[model samples]
Target: MSSGPSSYKIFDVTLKESVAMTPSLQHCVFYSEDVANMARHAPDQRIKVVLPLAGGEPPCLVDNGGWYPAWLALPAERRPPMRTYTLRNVRPAQGELDIDFVRNGDNGPASRWVNHARIGDRLQLIAPNAAFDGNGSGFEWLPPDGVRQVLLVADETALPAALSILESLSAQASPPQVQAFFEVPLCTDVQALDHYTFAKIHWLPREEQPHQPYGQSLLAALQTRLQIPDDAPRTQDEAAQGILRPELEQMWESAAPAHSAFYGWIACESSGVKALRRYLIHSCGLQRETLSLMAYWCHSR
Candidate 1:
């Protein structure tokens, strides 16, 4: 299959420097000759990063039946171990790009590189790739005109996508009320993002205990704050409603009374997002076309 016209571009960017976006978040401002030649990207687009791991670091991209073309044809040691991250923001006019890295433990090379990234750090960035139309605002399920309310959900990995979505929605002819949810390990993990929108943002901190189930806790808090109703059917419907059924139902009900259609973007753990998608489709009766569910980082990926 041929990529008709590559929506993604590859660039070599030198990190002029890094800034502490928050106690747990760092902003890496990078520049590239390639970035200067690229075209403007939609707000929700993302890029792929090719990270070279240190010796003895476990290869994150494995030789799996040649399934990953991006990593194929390279010597094992020098092969780029790639990770996809949302483009937090782009200042095409200034020829600068921003990507936020959560200061999680450096168990992985990407995390390690980000933690120690500094001035003159070299990084390769594939050009911004347009979002899958189905999961993007371009999808038919999203409000064609304007909505009164919107709900955004994601873990730290998905925060960038959520932020971009909110910012894009803010620029619409008439934007909706936006509520963003993010969960990270540390309370200080929260950071000030590009405030190009008029949405109310909320952050939830995940416990740091090893082996603690952060996914379940996030679902619970979201359900409580959203006031998911107690009248949900207890059997098939409940299970079909997915992990956050009650909360999604509440959102649907509330938004309905105001003639508002919601664009629900949930990107997080693969297992968890499967449930969120189920709730949106099976429980809340949301049109599948309107929901954007992405597994930013999956355990099995």
Candidate 2:
């Protein structure tokens, strides 16, 4: 079962409930008896959602002629709009899935729809055939066997995926040392995630640093707090004391006994992600293979 555009499947869902995770974040749960294998999806993957157009009916399936071509062939008035969203959580027994949307007014179709969505409102989604690529679902998050420490950075847009990854990691037999930093518009936006006791969660409120641009605060924090100095003493005590950056650097230094493998996952706005990726690779000396950096969205010019 190889997953690709051709392996997409349509599922009909009814909005079971909607909850406000923050002032601007809405979490919607959709249930469908038709989607029996909900648990097969990997954490951090995404699903394509198709919203009704004009007075069209809900849960309509798109022709499997490829998304763009099929969408373009439809009449202007009959075409449905679609958006990709992270599959936040899934419950196979209950046939439920969750998606979190940022309520940004009418700036985007998905936001507008989520802002007004109500229980029982129907919708359709295209999900990957997990039977084919369960390990690498639509998004990739694979840490090597020796990885014993993980760093996660994300903004509001990437929060869903980041949290899902955290949850998945926490479920392992021996979870790694997890450090996560999340940037949100307001302090009220921070949600409690007690499921993972090993993760040290840091919430950065944008409102606190009004002068700083988006992502700058996060980058600065990572550099000042997380990035280890190149000249720091090489000792296991330093590694045990939370400085895994230097430990990672020692992995390639004369084949000395390497400390725990360090891995980083970052997702944010385009410019921010690029800058962070550069800092992790060039400045922190982290191997590119151990890091995953993605620009979930770009700032509007």
Candidate 3:
């Protein structure tokens, strides 16, 4: 997290392969000599992807903890667009990493690049330095000890992280009961994923109810499944149209509940996250510490 051996490093990586897992999801395999030292400490491990400059040249970067300031110090013209994403899978021995990109056409720099990304394309990844002591730099999937039920929710943007968490939980000796609600652009966007018997995945397709807002399907499913407090207000869209929290910064919080038997990890649009955070805590009486409600993105520019 800082200038230390156990923190992070920027690795220059080349895309070795790309597969269209779904129309909206691209599974890309990247290779780098230094990736062998990249650590996957948590299921939902976050990392930064530095996109190429206007001419498709590798963006200027510093391969150390000082990358952020150093990158910002560069002239605006030289500052590449950096985006956050989850590491789906990591094969340290194979010197490879897997990242799933949502192919949202021109939504932002990452989407634009993934739309045109091809084998041999190169980028910079700021990830954990496994070469030294283990560090949870960009990891955030921590549930309370002995949690009985885990609620995992996400839209297409956070699907990579939700799936990664599911896989890791399944490997546990005694996995908790998991109820996952994943909303994608369409049913076709759903892919076959690996999970355990205790995991019940409910894939909500916005296509069925084309009239509803993008994240309504997920919210409806959650309400129907979970118990809302008697005093909880009827659910409404919370997409941050008025803008209380910024998309990337105020959108993130990850601390497990100290005493609750249930834990939740929810990530979606900013307003939805805020609305749900309020309902779960104030309305439903879910402890503020019982969840990691993250706004993975925002609708605003």
All candidates: CA RMSD in angstroms?
7.1, 7.4, 5.1
Q: By TM-score, rank the candidates, best first.
A: 3, 2, 1
What is candidate 1's lDDT per residue for 1-301, written digit by digit as tens? Answer: 7433344445677787688767777778888655555543455466677676575333344323332454676577667667776667767667788887766667776778888776877767765434312222211124433355566777877776676676677677767666667877677777676564566666777754346454554565555664322331123445544545445532121111223344556677766666565654665556543456666675541
Q: What TM-score does candidate 2 reach? A: 0.81
Model 3: residues >4 Å from true position, as ranges?
1-6, 132-135, 193-195, 227-250
User: Best by lDDT, which number?
Assistant: 3
Which whole-number lDDT from 0 to 100 does residue 237 have in model 1?
48
Kindly indicate the candidate among 1 and 2 with the higher lDDT: 2
Query: What lDDT would each prediction earn against the true structure?
Result: 0.60, 0.73, 0.78
Judging by TM-score, tell me the better candidate of 1 and 3.
Answer: 3
Show the lowest summed lDDT stretch of 10 residues, model 3.
228-237
**Higher-ranked by TM-score: 1 or 2:** 2
Residue 260, candidate 1: C-alpha displacement in angstroms: 8.0
The candidate scoring highest on TM-score is 3
